[model samples]
Target: MTDHEDDLGPRVASFRELRGMSLRALAAAAGVSTSFLSQLENGRTNASVASLRKIAGALGVSPAELLDERAAHTRGVLRADRRPRLEGALGVEKFVLSLPPLRNLEVYAGEFAPGASTGANPYTHGNAQEMFVVIEGTVVFELGGERFEMSRDDSIEFLSSVPHRIVNESEAEARVIWINSPPTPDEAHGA
Candidate 1:
């Protein structure tokens, strides 16, 4: 295998393992044959775009994430301008503060314009833990049917499995820092 392919195989295998999926399980989820997946993971074959998409979908990540060269590097200090921004809801902007190999943790800085929110519906992740800290302005978080209002310097942490949504009702823009442990794969795609 070429160097790139060699690097890709281990990454695919590592992500699969991190999700606690066996080869057969991942193959089934990705709608590919177990043998084919084994070959791909062993660097014996390359994946087509369709296959990569399927694999990424099954892993709850974007194909771009699987293909990112930077994902292979571990940068100790990420510059402000170098941080990757995430696609968020209207009036909300999110920037990733953490670097590659996002297995254990993720940190993000978010700015929410007035009246912005994480939508009306609440969302949930698997078993990850999350913390949100308000840097400026005020925001409210609704978690598991309870509402909590937070202001500058205030923080909250909880299991991400609980249904939650964030809201900025103030007239001013709100800024926050979000930290997650055992980062959710969907977050990798800015979901």
Candidate 2:
């Protein structure tokens, strides 16, 4: 197996431990065999994409998060120019504002061009908390089943599990800061 597969095993085990899940419990939750799970965790075997997805779901994280190297170490200072930028979807651009090895919290900065949006459909995370602060212009946020319009300096905090989407419906571009507690399961690669 490749080195990444070997590294993946321990990371999966770590996340399982963080969630206070036993091998059997996680195996059952992911609908995988205990032996297979053990072998995967011990680096004796590699996992397929579907297996990784199942395990990540059972661990309350995204598959990509389980494979993220940035989640393994902590950085004290994050220079602005050094922030990692993500290849955004739609007209939205995102940057990781926090240093590596995200533990309890993560911070991000996003810019949405006029008429841009997070996506057509809302997405949900696991049991975490999120805060969004509008830095400039205006944006509309749909959280749960309600829609809230926010302007510069406006902020809102909500459960990450709630289905949500952000849209920049204004004539000008909008900027926002996104903060997540207990960090969501998304990978951030630094520039």
Predicted structure with the largest lDDT when compared to the true one:
2
Estimate every model's Cα lDDT from 0 to 1.
Answer: 0.81, 0.82
lDDT (tens digit, per residue) of candidate 1 on 116-139 = 987778888766789989999999
RMSD of 1: 7.5
* lDDT per residue as tens, model 2, 14-89: 8776555689988998999999999998988889999999988887677877788555332235677888888877
What TM-score would every model get versus the actual structure? Answer: 0.59, 0.58
Candidate 2 RMSD computed on C-alpha atoms after optimal superposition onto the true structure: 10.3
CA lDDT for candidate 1 = 0.81
Name the regions of candidate 2 deviating beyond 4 angstroms: 1-77, 187-191
Q: Least accurate stretch of 10 residues (summed lDDT) in model 1?
A: 68-77
Clashes in candidate 2: how many?
1
The prediction achieving the highest TM-score against the true structure is 1
